[model samples]
Target: MSLLPPNKKKVAKETPRNFVIFGETMNGKTYFTEEFPNPINLNTDGNAEMIETPSINISHQRDSKGTITKSVSDVLSDVIDELQGTKHGFETIVLDTIDDIITLFEQEICEGEGVKSIGDIGWGKGHAMLEMMVRVLIMRLKELSMKKKVNILYISRSIDIEENDVSKQVPSLKKKWMNIVNGNSDYTILCRKIGKQYIRKVESKRKNYTRDKIDDEQIASLLDTVIGAYEKSKKTDVKDAKKIVEQQEKQEELEQKAKRKEREEEAAGESTKDNPDPKQDKQPEQAPKEVTKEPEQSKKQPTARRRPPRQARS
Candidate 1:
């Protein structure tokens, strides 16, 4: 009764991807994001002047007295609202350098708790609050991907980590926040500078990065390839499903024919038993007797009657 193809795993429909693109400073992390379709950058690092892509400056709000009114988190919420409420026609939304955004969030947390630094908060609650705030932001971006079909790209700088004397690069965020970002994102690509050429690490294998040459024009080709594979898998599933259905139909037809033949044979046997052929059931005929000529005797036989009753009366 299943709707999926026989012996084939079900594949989900293609949707926009959320990416965490991280690399060292000036390694083209922000520049590569512009290759996505119809992209707009949420410029938080004050580097919007360097990029030609459309961007919105995300900054804290202040009053005339220089007292802080709105936090960066609040401004991000407003941006999400505008994207959801209005038809912005933007296909991709980039958070330019999420490292700066995290820093702003930490500052906002410190200001709210009246502390000089995040560590001053009692019982390590400040870190927990910051993590929650970042998680909320990621969830909101996911909503945009779901409801509006928008792709989200978070840009960050990579920090090197040493483990077992092997160095590896990861996003420039705290371990807890980094885990959150990587878990929530569909892709965690690394931009590396190999000599003068820029290459992107699309996948990782046993500390060996799978590199792909990228430029401003073809940075988004990975997404295209993924979507194309999805389409091909879908078509294959449909074809397999149709073939299975046809096979089931043929098997059923054969079964029906067998049943019909069995029924006909039973009917013929019953008819033969009910009415047998008369010629085959008839008894054997005897020879006709010959009539012989005989002499006429003409003598009548006399009968002796009983007269005992009359004698007894006399």
Candidate 2:
């Protein structure tokens, strides 16, 4: 680490994406979703016949009064529950015409507020609630895609609307909800019928995840362009990788410091060995030896005296 570094290292990781595919009445929107592996359709529009792939149809439950009605939340909750089951064997989750789900939510809101339309809720509360519901839905779908590791394809019909004095075909959802959906999705695919042939176009492509299992060559080509653009984008991933790199650098620095200290100690020892002190190198002096003497022996006069005394006694 330094005050002025060359550049911040950039890293990228795969992030699973959720897609929104929109088009006209019969421009291959549902068919496009079918290209995904093991797709389970949530037929909100009750138009499963149009989709060639089989789907999981959720029935409207009756209340205590025996009235056949369904709450949007209840239906979505059931789908989430099914997704939680590991034995379900669904690889992808498809929602045909998310516009229908929005309408269902609107109907539920109206029923709760005792109104004929969402506008009747007054003070734009209905719209606020609608946006909230849409946000929740988008968040849950993101969980399904990212946490559950399943691909999500939301199909919706396009509508011709004037935006900033220009008429453009967009997904048939309110502006707020549409913006949220587009922002959350990794790709917004636009399906259009040009002449007798249908064409798929990428309206937006900003995601870290790349979908590779596409059967249609044309659609796959378009997706390749999107993935290439994402690859070229200026993005950085601030994940645990950065932390791991920092830790490795720190460990290397500590090791280098230890090696330098050891070298310094060895050099000091070698200098002491090569340059000796004269005084300490000299041999110690020997102590002086003690002179020892033995006393002279006395003459044997006692023996002469003893012989004279014996002669006198005799």
Residues 197-228, model 1: lDDT tens digits: 77776532112112232222333355443222
- In candidate 1, residue 216 scores what lDDT? 24
Clashing pairs in 2: none
Q: How many residue pairs clash in each candidate?
A: 0, 0
lDDT by residue (198-240, candidate 2, tens digit) is 7776677665444454433443444653324234345556876
Local lDDT at 243 for model 1: 92
**What is the Cα-based TM-score of model 1?**
0.62
Task: Locate the minimum summed-lDDT window of 10 residues in model 2.
Answer: 225-234
Give candidates' CA RMSD values in order: 28.0, 27.6
lDDT of 1: 0.76
